[model samples]
Target: MPALNIDFSDEELAELRETAKARGVTLKSLVREAVTEDLAQRRALAAMTAVLRAFTAEHTTAFDDAFPDDAPTGARRRGAA
Candidate 1:
């Protein structure tokens, strides 16, 4: 595996080290986990956005009909169930 070097201010590095120590993890491990989670979240959000765009384009009429502009309030629609 290759190594990557990152630069951080003294205060920032100190904070990261303190947090990592508290969590019983190395700074590298903590940073790696955070980066991995952030990337995964970004990928999932992009996929969801693409799917929503496609669905909206394909089912515009049906979607509109089901939730019309002047539909009754949710409470009224649910009734006394």
Candidate 2:
């Protein structure tokens, strides 16, 4: 596999090294895990946004009509008055 080089300030590098040592992991492993998790979170958010947009496009009018101006205010459980 290819390798990548990153530059960090002395303070930042020291902090990362300290955190990795405290976790009993190498700095590379710690950084790799963080990057992986961030990418996954971003992908999940994008997917959720797409689904919401599609649902809104398909149901905007129906959703609006279901809650007309005189809709009741308080909360109610299923099959409740």
Candidate 3:
């Protein structure tokens, strides 16, 4: 695998080293895991946003003022139980 070169302040390096030691992994592995998880989260969010946008466009009238309760779906609206 290709090596990655990164620069960090002494303080930041110390923090990273401590975190890696706490997690029982090398700095390289910790960074790799963090980067992978971050990318996966970003991709999942992007896909969910795309789907919501498509749903909104396809059901414009149905959703208009239908969710007056701005809360999540499980919550009841103002006049509904």
On TM-score, the candidate that comes out on top is: 2
- Candidate 1, residues 1-81, lDDT tens digits: the string is 988899999999999999999999999999999999999999999999999978866765565578887444555443322
Worst 10 residues of 3 by lDDT: 71-80
Q: What's the lDDT of the predicted structure labeled candidate 3? A: 0.79
lDDT of 2: 0.80
TM-score of 3: 0.75
Tens-place lDDT per residue, model 3, 3-44, is 889999999999999999999999999989998999999999
**Model 2 Cα shift for residue 25 (angstroms):** 0.5
| Candidate 1 off by > 4 Å | 64-81
Assess each prediction's global lDDT (C-alpha) against the native. Answer: 0.83, 0.80, 0.79
Pick by lDDT: 1 or 2, better one = 1
| Cα distance off (Å), candidate 3, residue 22 | 0.7
RMSD of 3: 8.3
Where does candidate 3 clash, by residue pair?
Answer: none
What would the per-residue lDDT of candidate 2 be over residues 1-81, giving only the tens digit for each residue? Answer: 988899999999999999999999999999999989999999999999999978866765566568655443444211135
Candidate ordering by TM-score (highest first): 2, 3, 1
The order by descending lDDT is 1, 2, 3
